[model samples]
Target: MLTSKQKKYLKSEAHSLKPIFQIGKDGVSHKQAMTILDALEKKELIKVKLLDTCPLTVQQAALEISMQTKAEVVHIIGHTIILYKESEKEIYKLP
Candidate 1:
Protein backbone atom coordinates (compact mmCIF):
# COMPACT_ATOMS: atom_id res chain seq x y z
CA MET A 1 0.00 0.00 0.00
CA LEU A 2 1.17 3.51 -0.74
CA THR A 3 1.63 6.00 2.04
CA SER A 4 -0.50 9.16 1.99
CA LYS A 5 2.56 11.20 1.11
CA GLN A 6 3.44 8.93 -1.80
CA LYS A 7 -0.12 9.10 -3.09
CA LYS A 8 -0.09 12.88 -2.83
CA TYR A 9 3.13 13.08 -4.79
CA LEU A 10 1.88 10.68 -7.43
CA LYS A 11 -1.36 12.64 -7.79
CA SER A 12 0.62 15.75 -8.62
CA GLU A 13 2.86 13.87 -11.03
CA ALA A 14 -0.14 12.38 -12.81
CA HIS A 15 -1.79 15.74 -13.31
CA SER A 16 0.18 16.38 -16.48
CA LEU A 17 -0.09 12.90 -17.96
CA LYS A 18 -2.64 11.97 -20.60
CA PRO A 19 -4.75 8.94 -20.11
CA ILE A 20 -2.93 6.01 -21.73
CA PHE A 21 -5.87 3.61 -21.83
CA GLN A 22 -9.64 3.81 -21.86
CA ILE A 23 -12.05 1.20 -20.53
CA GLY A 24 -15.11 1.08 -22.78
CA LYS A 25 -18.30 -0.99 -22.96
CA ASP A 26 -16.32 -4.21 -22.97
CA GLY A 27 -14.68 -3.29 -19.67
CA VAL A 28 -11.18 -4.57 -18.83
CA SER A 29 -9.67 -7.19 -21.14
CA HIS A 30 -6.54 -9.27 -21.32
CA LYS A 31 -5.22 -7.09 -24.12
CA GLN A 32 -5.79 -4.01 -22.03
CA ALA A 33 -4.08 -5.61 -19.02
CA MET A 34 -1.05 -6.45 -21.16
CA THR A 35 -0.92 -2.92 -22.45
CA ILE A 36 -1.16 -1.52 -18.95
CA LEU A 37 1.57 -3.84 -17.73
CA ASP A 38 3.82 -2.76 -20.54
CA ALA A 39 3.12 0.90 -19.96
CA LEU A 40 3.75 0.51 -16.22
CA GLU A 41 7.02 -1.22 -16.96
CA LYS A 42 8.14 1.59 -19.20
CA LYS A 43 6.71 4.64 -17.44
CA GLU A 44 6.14 3.47 -13.84
CA LEU A 45 3.03 5.66 -13.70
CA ILE A 46 -0.01 5.77 -16.01
CA LYS A 47 -3.54 7.08 -16.23
CA VAL A 48 -6.58 5.15 -17.42
CA LYS A 49 -9.97 6.56 -18.29
CA LEU A 50 -13.28 4.81 -17.76
CA LEU A 51 -15.58 5.74 -20.59
CA ASP A 52 -19.31 6.29 -20.16
CA THR A 53 -19.89 3.09 -22.10
CA CYS A 54 -17.89 1.05 -19.64
CA PRO A 55 -19.84 -1.42 -17.52
CA LEU A 56 -17.75 -0.79 -14.40
CA THR A 57 -17.38 2.32 -12.32
CA VAL A 58 -14.05 4.14 -12.06
CA GLN A 59 -13.28 2.42 -8.75
CA GLN A 60 -14.16 -1.02 -10.05
CA ALA A 61 -12.17 -0.63 -13.21
CA ALA A 62 -9.23 0.68 -11.24
CA LEU A 63 -9.39 -2.23 -8.84
CA GLU A 64 -9.62 -4.79 -11.60
CA ILE A 65 -6.81 -3.29 -13.57
CA SER A 66 -4.65 -2.92 -10.46
CA MET A 67 -5.17 -6.58 -9.69
CA GLN A 68 -4.35 -7.71 -13.20
CA THR A 69 -1.27 -5.57 -13.62
CA LYS A 70 -0.05 -5.68 -10.00
CA ALA A 71 0.06 -1.91 -9.91
CA GLU A 72 -1.08 0.42 -7.18
CA VAL A 73 -4.11 2.70 -7.73
CA VAL A 74 -2.66 6.10 -6.94
CA HIS A 75 -5.80 8.15 -7.46
CA ILE A 76 -9.17 8.30 -9.18
CA ILE A 77 -10.76 11.55 -10.21
CA GLY A 78 -13.99 11.76 -12.19
CA HIS A 79 -13.60 8.93 -14.73
CA THR A 80 -9.84 8.75 -14.66
CA ILE A 81 -7.65 6.49 -12.53
CA ILE A 82 -3.94 6.80 -11.88
CA LEU A 83 -1.84 3.68 -11.48
CA TYR A 84 1.77 3.22 -10.39
CA LYS A 85 4.17 0.30 -10.41
CA GLU A 86 7.89 0.11 -9.82
CA SER A 87 9.85 -0.86 -12.89
CA GLU A 88 12.61 -3.37 -12.23
CA LYS A 89 15.31 -1.29 -13.87
CA GLU A 90 13.81 2.19 -13.76
CA ILE A 91 11.73 2.49 -10.62
CA TYR A 92 10.16 5.84 -9.71
CA LYS A 93 10.98 6.91 -6.19
CA LEU A 94 8.05 8.48 -4.37
CA PRO A 95 8.74 11.50 -2.22
Candidate 2:
Protein backbone atom coordinates (compact mmCIF):
# COMPACT_ATOMS: atom_id res chain seq x y z
CA MET A 1 0.00 0.00 0.00
CA LEU A 2 1.22 3.48 -0.83
CA THR A 3 1.01 6.30 1.65
CA SER A 4 -0.80 9.41 0.48
CA LYS A 5 2.52 11.25 0.35
CA GLN A 6 4.09 8.61 -1.87
CA LYS A 7 1.09 8.62 -4.14
CA LYS A 8 1.27 12.39 -4.38
CA TYR A 9 4.91 12.21 -5.38
CA LEU A 10 4.20 9.56 -7.98
CA LYS A 11 1.32 11.57 -9.39
CA SER A 12 3.61 14.53 -9.93
CA GLU A 13 6.29 12.35 -11.49
CA ALA A 14 3.78 10.83 -13.88
CA HIS A 15 2.16 14.14 -14.82
CA SER A 16 4.21 14.58 -17.99
CA LEU A 17 4.25 10.94 -19.03
CA LYS A 18 2.12 9.72 -21.89
CA PRO A 19 -0.02 6.70 -21.33
CA ILE A 20 2.04 3.57 -21.85
CA PHE A 21 -1.03 1.52 -22.62
CA GLN A 22 -4.69 1.96 -23.42
CA ILE A 23 -7.74 -0.06 -22.39
CA GLY A 24 -10.37 0.02 -25.10
CA LYS A 25 -13.63 -1.77 -25.84
CA ASP A 26 -12.09 -5.16 -25.19
CA GLY A 27 -11.33 -4.06 -21.65
CA VAL A 28 -8.49 -5.39 -19.53
CA SER A 29 -7.08 -8.71 -20.65
CA HIS A 30 -4.55 -11.17 -19.29
CA LYS A 31 -2.09 -10.39 -22.02
CA GLN A 32 -2.38 -6.67 -21.46
CA ALA A 33 -1.96 -7.09 -17.73
CA MET A 34 1.17 -9.17 -18.22
CA THR A 35 2.57 -6.59 -20.58
CA ILE A 36 1.82 -3.89 -18.01
CA LEU A 37 3.63 -5.96 -15.38
CA ASP A 38 6.69 -5.99 -17.59
CA ALA A 39 6.42 -2.27 -18.11
CA LEU A 40 6.06 -1.58 -14.39
CA GLU A 41 9.17 -3.62 -13.74
CA LYS A 42 11.08 -1.43 -16.11
CA LYS A 43 9.57 1.98 -15.45
CA GLU A 44 8.32 1.72 -11.82
CA LEU A 45 5.62 4.26 -12.65
CA ILE A 46 3.33 4.35 -15.72
CA LYS A 47 0.13 5.87 -17.00
CA VAL A 48 -2.71 3.92 -18.58
CA LYS A 49 -5.48 5.60 -20.49
CA LEU A 50 -9.03 4.38 -20.88
CA LEU A 51 -10.72 5.15 -24.14
CA ASP A 52 -14.31 6.23 -24.57
CA THR A 53 -15.10 2.85 -26.11
CA CYS A 54 -14.11 0.99 -22.99
CA PRO A 55 -16.94 -0.69 -21.12
CA LEU A 56 -15.37 -0.78 -17.68
CA THR A 57 -15.25 2.23 -15.44
CA VAL A 58 -11.90 3.74 -14.46
CA GLN A 59 -12.12 2.24 -10.94
CA GLN A 60 -12.92 -1.21 -12.23
CA ALA A 61 -10.12 -1.23 -14.78
CA ALA A 62 -7.70 0.12 -12.20
CA LEU A 63 -8.60 -2.68 -9.77
CA GLU A 64 -8.30 -5.42 -12.36
CA ILE A 65 -4.97 -4.17 -13.64
CA SER A 66 -3.67 -3.62 -10.13
CA MET A 67 -4.69 -7.12 -9.09
CA GLN A 68 -3.17 -8.70 -12.17
CA THR A 69 0.07 -6.74 -12.17
CA LYS A 70 0.41 -6.47 -8.37
CA ALA A 71 1.11 -2.78 -8.81
CA GLU A 72 -0.36 -0.03 -6.71
CA VAL A 73 -2.87 2.37 -8.25
CA VAL A 74 -1.26 5.66 -7.40
CA HIS A 75 -3.93 7.89 -8.76
CA ILE A 76 -6.86 8.09 -11.17
CA ILE A 77 -7.93 11.31 -12.84
CA GLY A 78 -10.23 11.77 -15.78
CA HIS A 79 -9.66 8.61 -17.84
CA THR A 80 -6.04 8.14 -16.92
CA ILE A 81 -4.58 5.98 -14.16
CA ILE A 82 -1.14 6.18 -12.64
CA LEU A 83 0.34 2.90 -11.39
CA TYR A 84 3.50 2.25 -9.44
CA LYS A 85 5.54 -0.80 -8.49
CA GLU A 86 8.95 -0.75 -6.95
CA SER A 87 11.49 -2.26 -9.31
CA GLU A 88 14.93 -3.73 -8.88
CA LYS A 89 16.33 -0.62 -10.52
CA GLU A 90 14.72 1.56 -7.81
CA ILE A 91 13.87 4.01 -10.56
CA TYR A 92 11.89 6.52 -8.48
CA LYS A 93 12.81 7.21 -4.89
CA LEU A 94 9.46 7.34 -3.13
CA PRO A 95 8.75 9.59 -0.17
Candidate 3:
Protein backbone atom coordinates (compact mmCIF):
# COMPACT_ATOMS: atom_id res chain seq x y z
CA MET A 1 0.00 0.00 0.00
CA LEU A 2 1.10 3.53 -0.71
CA THR A 3 0.67 6.60 1.45
CA SER A 4 -1.25 9.65 0.27
CA LYS A 5 1.96 11.61 -0.18
CA GLN A 6 3.54 8.82 -2.20
CA LYS A 7 0.49 8.50 -4.41
CA LYS A 8 0.46 12.25 -4.97
CA TYR A 9 4.11 12.22 -5.90
CA LEU A 10 3.70 9.32 -8.27
CA LYS A 11 0.69 10.90 -9.93
CA SER A 12 2.65 14.04 -10.70
CA GLU A 13 5.63 12.09 -11.96
CA ALA A 14 3.46 9.97 -14.22
CA HIS A 15 1.62 12.90 -15.74
CA SER A 16 4.20 13.35 -18.46
CA LEU A 17 4.45 9.67 -19.41
CA LYS A 18 2.39 8.24 -22.21
CA PRO A 19 0.68 4.87 -21.88
CA ILE A 20 3.25 2.21 -22.68
CA PHE A 21 0.89 -0.76 -22.37
CA GLN A 22 -2.71 -1.51 -23.09
CA ILE A 23 -5.21 -4.14 -21.98
CA GLY A 24 -7.71 -5.03 -24.66
CA LYS A 25 -10.61 -7.49 -25.02
CA ASP A 26 -8.31 -10.47 -24.45
CA GLY A 27 -7.28 -9.10 -21.08
CA VAL A 28 -3.85 -9.67 -19.56
CA SER A 29 -1.76 -12.63 -20.68
CA HIS A 30 1.31 -14.21 -19.13
CA LYS A 31 3.53 -12.94 -21.92
CA GLN A 32 2.19 -9.43 -21.51
CA ALA A 33 2.78 -9.60 -17.77
CA MET A 34 6.38 -10.58 -18.37
CA THR A 35 6.78 -7.72 -20.80
CA ILE A 36 5.35 -5.28 -18.30
CA LEU A 37 7.67 -6.67 -15.63
CA ASP A 38 10.63 -5.89 -17.79
CA ALA A 39 9.41 -2.38 -18.50
CA LEU A 40 8.75 -1.79 -14.83
CA GLU A 41 12.32 -2.73 -13.96
CA LYS A 42 13.66 -0.02 -16.18
CA LYS A 43 10.97 2.65 -15.84
CA GLU A 44 9.80 2.10 -12.25
CA LEU A 45 6.69 4.09 -13.16
CA ILE A 46 4.45 3.75 -16.21
CA LYS A 47 1.02 4.44 -17.62
CA VAL A 48 -1.30 1.80 -19.06
CA LYS A 49 -4.46 2.20 -21.06
CA LEU A 50 -7.47 -0.10 -20.86
CA LEU A 51 -9.51 0.00 -24.00
CA ASP A 52 -13.30 -0.02 -23.96
CA THR A 53 -13.21 -3.50 -25.47
CA CYS A 54 -11.55 -4.73 -22.31
CA PRO A 55 -13.87 -6.77 -20.10
CA LEU A 56 -12.63 -4.96 -17.01
CA THR A 57 -12.79 -1.31 -16.08
CA VAL A 58 -9.73 0.92 -15.80
CA GLN A 59 -9.58 0.49 -12.03
CA GLN A 60 -9.96 -3.28 -12.25
CA ALA A 61 -7.30 -3.64 -14.92
CA ALA A 62 -4.98 -1.38 -12.97
CA LEU A 63 -5.39 -3.37 -9.76
CA GLU A 64 -5.05 -6.72 -11.52
CA ILE A 65 -1.94 -5.68 -13.37
CA SER A 66 -0.41 -4.22 -10.24
CA MET A 67 -1.04 -7.48 -8.40
CA GLN A 68 0.46 -9.58 -11.17
CA THR A 69 3.57 -7.43 -11.53
CA LYS A 70 3.96 -6.44 -7.88
CA ALA A 71 3.63 -2.76 -8.73
CA GLU A 72 1.41 -0.06 -7.28
CA VAL A 73 -1.58 1.56 -8.98
CA VAL A 74 -1.10 5.31 -8.67
CA HIS A 75 -4.28 6.43 -10.39
CA ILE A 76 -6.93 5.55 -12.93
CA ILE A 77 -8.39 8.37 -14.94
CA GLY A 78 -10.62 7.87 -17.94
CA HIS A 79 -9.12 4.83 -19.68
CA THR A 80 -5.65 5.46 -18.37
CA ILE A 81 -3.98 3.92 -15.33
CA ILE A 82 -0.66 4.88 -13.78
CA LEU A 83 1.56 2.28 -12.11
CA TYR A 84 4.71 2.48 -10.01
CA LYS A 85 7.28 0.15 -8.45
CA GLU A 86 10.70 0.64 -6.93
CA SER A 87 13.55 -0.79 -8.97
CA GLU A 88 15.70 -3.31 -7.14
CA LYS A 89 18.74 -1.97 -8.96
CA GLU A 90 18.04 1.39 -7.26
CA ILE A 91 18.40 3.00 -10.61
CA TYR A 92 14.86 4.35 -10.15
CA LYS A 93 12.67 5.13 -7.17
CA LEU A 94 8.90 5.70 -6.80
CA PRO A 95 9.39 8.91 -4.84
Candidate 4:
Protein backbone atom coordinates (compact mmCIF):
# COMPACT_ATOMS: atom_id res chain seq x y z
CA MET A 1 0.00 0.00 0.00
CA LEU A 2 1.04 3.58 -0.62
CA THR A 3 0.78 6.51 1.72
CA SER A 4 -1.32 9.50 0.65
CA LYS A 5 1.81 11.57 0.19
CA GLN A 6 3.44 8.84 -1.84
CA LYS A 7 0.42 8.56 -4.10
CA LYS A 8 0.30 12.31 -4.47
CA TYR A 9 3.95 12.41 -5.43
CA LEU A 10 3.48 9.62 -7.93
CA LYS A 11 0.50 11.40 -9.49
CA SER A 12 2.61 14.49 -10.01
CA GLU A 13 5.43 12.44 -11.46
CA ALA A 14 2.99 10.71 -13.81
CA HIS A 15 1.37 13.90 -15.05
CA SER A 16 3.64 14.29 -18.07
CA LEU A 17 3.64 10.62 -19.02
CA LYS A 18 1.57 9.35 -21.94
CA PRO A 19 -0.43 6.20 -21.62
CA ILE A 20 1.71 3.25 -22.59
CA PHE A 21 -1.18 0.85 -23.09
CA GLN A 22 -4.92 0.95 -23.63
CA ILE A 23 -7.72 -1.35 -22.67
CA GLY A 24 -10.08 -1.40 -25.60
CA LYS A 25 -13.34 -3.24 -26.39
CA ASP A 26 -11.68 -6.53 -25.57
CA GLY A 27 -10.97 -5.42 -22.02
CA VAL A 28 -8.03 -6.69 -19.94
CA SER A 29 -6.67 -9.93 -21.31
CA HIS A 30 -3.86 -12.23 -20.13
CA LYS A 31 -1.57 -10.96 -22.84
CA GLN A 32 -2.34 -7.41 -21.86
CA ALA A 33 -1.62 -8.24 -18.25
CA MET A 34 1.67 -9.82 -19.21
CA THR A 35 2.65 -6.81 -21.24
CA ILE A 36 1.78 -4.50 -18.39
CA LEU A 37 3.72 -6.64 -15.95
CA ASP A 38 6.73 -6.51 -18.23
CA ALA A 39 6.48 -2.76 -18.54
CA LEU A 40 6.09 -2.35 -14.81
CA GLU A 41 9.17 -4.44 -14.25
CA LYS A 42 11.15 -2.29 -16.64
CA LYS A 43 9.71 1.15 -15.90
CA GLU A 44 8.41 0.80 -12.31
CA LEU A 45 5.80 3.47 -13.01
CA ILE A 46 3.40 3.54 -15.96
CA LYS A 47 0.16 5.00 -17.20
CA VAL A 48 -2.67 3.08 -18.82
CA LYS A 49 -5.72 4.30 -20.66
CA LEU A 50 -9.21 2.90 -20.71
CA LEU A 51 -10.50 3.56 -24.18
CA ASP A 52 -14.07 4.65 -24.85
CA THR A 53 -14.67 1.27 -26.43
CA CYS A 54 -13.79 -0.58 -23.22
CA PRO A 55 -16.63 -2.25 -21.39
CA LEU A 56 -15.25 -2.26 -17.85
CA THR A 57 -15.40 0.65 -15.45
CA VAL A 58 -12.22 2.58 -14.60
CA GLN A 59 -12.21 1.19 -11.07
CA GLN A 60 -12.69 -2.31 -12.35
CA ALA A 61 -9.91 -2.11 -14.92
CA ALA A 62 -7.52 -0.50 -12.47
CA LEU A 63 -8.23 -3.08 -9.80
CA GLU A 64 -7.95 -5.98 -12.21
CA ILE A 65 -4.68 -4.83 -13.68
CA SER A 66 -3.21 -3.93 -10.32
CA MET A 67 -4.13 -7.34 -8.95
CA GLN A 68 -2.83 -9.22 -11.96
CA THR A 69 0.44 -7.35 -12.12
CA LYS A 70 0.90 -6.94 -8.35
CA ALA A 71 1.30 -3.20 -8.80
CA GLU A 72 -0.02 -0.27 -6.82
CA VAL A 73 -2.76 2.06 -8.16
CA VAL A 74 -1.19 5.46 -7.64
CA HIS A 75 -3.89 7.53 -9.30
CA ILE A 76 -6.82 7.54 -11.70
CA ILE A 77 -7.80 10.67 -13.54
CA GLY A 78 -10.36 10.74 -16.32
CA HIS A 79 -9.64 7.60 -18.37
CA THR A 80 -6.04 7.28 -17.28
CA ILE A 81 -4.62 5.22 -14.41
CA ILE A 82 -1.16 5.43 -12.91
CA LEU A 83 0.43 2.21 -11.68
CA TYR A 84 3.68 1.44 -9.90
CA LYS A 85 5.66 -1.59 -8.86
CA GLU A 86 9.12 -1.78 -7.38
CA SER A 87 11.63 -3.36 -9.72
CA GLU A 88 15.04 -4.90 -9.17
CA LYS A 89 16.56 -2.10 -11.23
CA GLU A 90 15.53 0.56 -8.66
CA ILE A 91 14.43 3.39 -10.91
CA TYR A 92 12.44 5.34 -8.28
CA LYS A 93 12.36 5.89 -4.56
CA LEU A 94 8.88 6.26 -3.07
CA PRO A 95 8.20 9.39 -1.09
Candidate 5:
Protein backbone atom coordinates (compact mmCIF):
# COMPACT_ATOMS: atom_id res chain seq x y z
CA MET A 1 0.00 0.00 0.00
CA LEU A 2 1.12 3.57 -0.67
CA THR A 3 0.91 6.37 1.81
CA SER A 4 -1.05 9.50 0.86
CA LYS A 5 2.21 11.45 0.67
CA GLN A 6 3.82 8.85 -1.57
CA LYS A 7 0.80 8.79 -3.83
CA LYS A 8 0.84 12.58 -3.98
CA TYR A 9 4.49 12.61 -4.94
CA LEU A 10 3.96 9.93 -7.56
CA LYS A 11 1.08 11.96 -9.03
CA SER A 12 3.44 14.89 -9.44
CA GLU A 13 6.15 12.72 -10.96
CA ALA A 14 3.62 11.23 -13.36
CA HIS A 15 2.22 14.60 -14.42
CA SER A 16 4.44 15.07 -17.47
CA LEU A 17 4.48 11.42 -18.52
CA LYS A 18 2.57 10.38 -21.64
CA PRO A 19 0.56 7.19 -21.52
CA ILE A 20 2.71 4.30 -22.75
CA PHE A 21 -0.23 1.96 -23.35
CA GLN A 22 -3.67 2.64 -24.80
CA ILE A 23 -6.90 0.91 -23.82
CA GLY A 24 -9.04 1.10 -26.95
CA LYS A 25 -12.43 -0.30 -28.00
CA ASP A 26 -11.07 -3.79 -27.50
CA GLY A 27 -10.38 -2.89 -23.88
CA VAL A 28 -8.04 -4.82 -21.58
CA SER A 29 -7.05 -8.26 -22.82
CA HIS A 30 -5.16 -11.18 -21.33
CA LYS A 31 -2.39 -10.62 -23.86
CA GLN A 32 -2.35 -6.93 -23.04
CA ALA A 33 -2.08 -7.80 -19.37
CA MET A 34 0.98 -9.92 -20.16
CA THR A 35 2.53 -7.09 -22.14
CA ILE A 36 1.77 -4.61 -19.39
CA LEU A 37 3.36 -6.95 -16.87
CA ASP A 38 6.48 -6.93 -19.00
CA ALA A 39 6.47 -3.14 -19.18
CA LEU A 40 5.92 -2.89 -15.43
CA GLU A 41 8.93 -5.12 -14.94
CA LYS A 42 11.04 -2.88 -17.13
CA LYS A 43 9.73 0.44 -15.88
CA GLU A 44 8.74 0.62 -12.24
CA LEU A 45 6.45 3.59 -12.91
CA ILE A 46 4.48 4.15 -16.06
CA LYS A 47 1.26 5.65 -17.42
CA VAL A 48 -1.60 4.13 -19.44
CA LYS A 49 -4.36 5.76 -21.44
CA LEU A 50 -7.97 4.64 -21.35
CA LEU A 51 -9.91 5.53 -24.47
CA ASP A 52 -13.45 6.93 -24.25
CA THR A 53 -14.68 4.05 -26.42
CA CYS A 54 -13.91 1.51 -23.74
CA PRO A 55 -16.95 0.46 -21.70
CA LEU A 56 -14.95 -0.21 -18.59
CA THR A 57 -14.24 2.59 -16.12
CA VAL A 58 -10.68 3.88 -15.60
CA GLN A 59 -10.88 2.54 -12.07
CA GLN A 60 -11.83 -0.84 -13.43
CA ALA A 61 -8.92 -0.76 -15.83
CA ALA A 62 -6.56 0.28 -13.08
CA LEU A 63 -7.89 -2.45 -10.80
CA GLU A 64 -7.48 -5.03 -13.52
CA ILE A 65 -3.92 -3.96 -14.27
CA SER A 66 -2.94 -3.89 -10.62
CA MET A 67 -4.50 -7.28 -9.95
CA GLN A 68 -2.84 -8.71 -13.02
CA THR A 69 0.66 -7.31 -12.44
CA LYS A 70 0.67 -7.26 -8.65
CA ALA A 71 1.47 -3.57 -8.84
CA GLU A 72 0.05 -0.42 -7.28
CA VAL A 73 -2.17 2.27 -8.81
CA VAL A 74 -0.19 5.43 -8.19
CA HIS A 75 -2.80 7.75 -9.63
CA ILE A 76 -5.57 8.24 -12.20
CA ILE A 77 -6.22 11.62 -13.75
CA GLY A 78 -8.45 12.34 -16.69
CA HIS A 79 -7.90 9.41 -19.06
CA THR A 80 -4.43 8.46 -17.82
CA ILE A 81 -3.57 5.94 -15.16
CA ILE A 82 -0.25 5.55 -13.33
CA LEU A 83 1.07 2.19 -12.18
CA TYR A 84 4.10 1.13 -10.12
CA LYS A 85 5.92 -2.04 -9.22
CA GLU A 86 9.35 -2.01 -7.64
CA SER A 87 12.00 -2.95 -10.17
CA GLU A 88 13.40 -6.38 -9.65
CA LYS A 89 16.89 -5.31 -10.71
CA GLU A 90 16.94 -2.87 -7.84
CA ILE A 91 14.61 -1.61 -5.13
CA TYR A 92 12.95 1.40 -6.72
CA LYS A 93 11.97 3.41 -3.70
CA LEU A 94 8.87 5.62 -3.77
CA PRO A 95 8.96 9.15 -2.55
Candidate 6:
Protein backbone atom coordinates (compact mmCIF):
# COMPACT_ATOMS: atom_id res chain seq x y z
CA MET A 1 0.00 0.00 0.00
CA LEU A 2 1.16 3.52 -0.68
CA THR A 3 0.78 6.55 1.53
CA SER A 4 -0.77 9.76 0.19
CA LYS A 5 2.64 11.38 -0.15
CA GLN A 6 4.06 8.41 -2.00
CA LYS A 7 1.15 8.39 -4.42
CA LYS A 8 1.58 12.09 -5.01
CA TYR A 9 5.25 11.64 -5.74
CA LEU A 10 4.56 8.77 -8.10
CA LYS A 11 1.90 10.79 -9.93
CA SER A 12 4.42 13.54 -10.57
CA GLU A 13 7.05 11.09 -11.70
CA ALA A 14 4.61 9.48 -14.13
CA HIS A 15 3.34 12.75 -15.55
CA SER A 16 5.67 12.75 -18.53
CA LEU A 17 5.48 9.03 -19.24
CA LYS A 18 3.57 7.69 -22.23
CA PRO A 19 1.08 4.91 -21.71
CA ILE A 20 2.88 1.61 -22.01
CA PHE A 21 -0.33 -0.30 -22.56
CA GLN A 22 -3.86 0.23 -23.67
CA ILE A 23 -7.19 -1.41 -22.81
CA GLY A 24 -9.44 -1.45 -25.85
CA LYS A 25 -12.73 -3.06 -26.87
CA ASP A 26 -11.56 -6.47 -25.77
CA GLY A 27 -11.15 -5.16 -22.24
CA VAL A 28 -8.72 -6.54 -19.68
CA SER A 29 -7.57 -10.12 -20.22
CA HIS A 30 -5.39 -12.59 -18.38
CA LYS A 31 -2.70 -12.33 -21.03
CA GLN A 32 -2.79 -8.55 -20.87
CA ALA A 33 -2.57 -8.62 -17.10
CA MET A 34 0.36 -11.00 -17.19
CA THR A 35 2.10 -8.81 -19.74
CA ILE A 36 1.52 -5.83 -17.47
CA LEU A 37 3.01 -7.79 -14.59
CA ASP A 38 6.11 -8.39 -16.64
CA ALA A 39 6.34 -4.71 -17.47
CA LEU A 40 5.85 -3.79 -13.83
CA GLU A 41 8.77 -6.00 -12.92
CA LYS A 42 10.97 -3.82 -15.11
CA LYS A 43 9.41 -0.41 -14.47
CA GLU A 44 8.13 0.39 -11.02
CA LEU A 45 5.72 2.95 -12.37
CA ILE A 46 3.73 2.77 -15.63
CA LYS A 47 0.83 4.39 -17.39
CA VAL A 48 -2.08 2.54 -19.02
CA LYS A 49 -4.53 4.20 -21.32
CA LEU A 50 -8.16 3.24 -21.92
CA LEU A 51 -9.63 3.77 -25.33
CA ASP A 52 -13.18 5.00 -25.91
CA THR A 53 -14.24 1.62 -27.25
CA CYS A 54 -13.27 -0.17 -24.07
CA PRO A 55 -16.10 -2.01 -22.39
CA LEU A 56 -14.97 -1.28 -18.84
CA THR A 57 -14.92 2.03 -17.11
CA VAL A 58 -11.67 3.59 -15.94
CA GLN A 59 -12.29 2.55 -12.32
CA GLN A 60 -13.15 -1.01 -13.30
CA ALA A 61 -10.14 -1.38 -15.59
CA ALA A 62 -7.87 0.07 -12.92
CA LEU A 63 -9.28 -2.30 -10.31
CA GLU A 64 -8.92 -5.39 -12.49
CA ILE A 65 -5.41 -4.57 -13.67
CA SER A 66 -4.17 -3.64 -10.22
CA MET A 67 -5.71 -6.78 -8.76
CA GLN A 68 -4.13 -8.98 -11.41
CA THR A 69 -0.68 -7.35 -11.36
CA LYS A 70 -0.64 -6.72 -7.61
CA ALA A 71 0.27 -3.15 -8.39
CA GLU A 72 -1.12 -0.05 -6.73
CA VAL A 73 -3.25 2.35 -8.74
CA VAL A 74 -1.44 5.61 -8.04
CA HIS A 75 -3.63 7.91 -10.07
CA ILE A 76 -6.39 7.98 -12.74
CA ILE A 77 -6.98 11.05 -14.84
CA GLY A 78 -8.94 11.37 -18.07
CA HIS A 79 -8.48 7.95 -19.67
CA THR A 80 -5.05 7.26 -18.28
CA ILE A 81 -4.09 5.33 -15.15
CA ILE A 82 -0.80 5.41 -13.29
CA LEU A 83 0.23 2.18 -11.59
CA TYR A 84 3.13 1.53 -9.22
CA LYS A 85 4.76 -1.57 -7.84
CA GLU A 86 8.06 -1.65 -6.03
CA SER A 87 10.37 -3.60 -8.30
CA GLU A 88 13.61 -5.42 -7.50
CA LYS A 89 15.53 -2.50 -8.99
CA GLU A 90 13.91 0.06 -6.64
CA ILE A 91 13.81 2.41 -9.59
CA TYR A 92 11.99 5.34 -7.99
CA LYS A 93 12.77 6.54 -4.49
CA LEU A 94 9.43 7.66 -3.15
CA PRO A 95 9.35 10.22 -0.35
lDDT tens readout by residue for model 1, 16-51:
999989899999998989999999999999999889
- TM-scores for candidates 1 onward, in order: 0.94, 0.98, 0.89, 0.97, 0.89, 0.98
Worst 10 residues of 1 by lDDT: 86-95
- What TM-score does prediction 2 earn? 0.98
User: What's the C-alpha lDDT at position 13 in model 4?
Assistant: 84
Name the TM-score of candidate 6: 0.98
| Model 2 weakest 10-residue run by lDDT | 2-11
Query: What is candidate 6's lDDT per residue for 32-87, written digit by digit as tens?
Result: 99999999999989999999999999999999999999999999999999999999
Point out where model 1 deviates above 4 Å: none
**Pairs clashing in candidate 6?**
none
The lDDT, on a scale of 0 to 1, for candidate 6 is 0.96
lDDT of each: 0.92, 0.96, 0.84, 0.94, 0.86, 0.96
The C-alpha stretches of model 2 lying farther than 4 A from their native spots are none
Cα RMSD, each candidate: 1.0, 0.5, 1.5, 0.7, 1.5, 0.5
Per-residue alpha-carbon lDDT of candidate 4 for residues 25-80, written as tens digits (9 for 90 to 100): 99999899999999999999999999999999999999999989999999999999
> Which pairs of residues have clashing backbones in candidate 3?
none
| Prediction 3 TM-score vs. true | 0.89
Q: What shift in Å separates residue 4 of candidate 2 from its native position after superposition?
A: 0.9
lDDT score of residue 56 within candidate 4: 98
lDDT of 2 by residue, 1-95 (tens): 99999988999999899998999999999999999999999999999999999999999999999999999999999999999999999999988
Q: What is the lDDT of candidate 3?
A: 0.84
Error of 4 at 24 (Å): 0.3
Better of 4 and 5 by lDDT: 4
**lDDT for position 85 in model 2:** 96
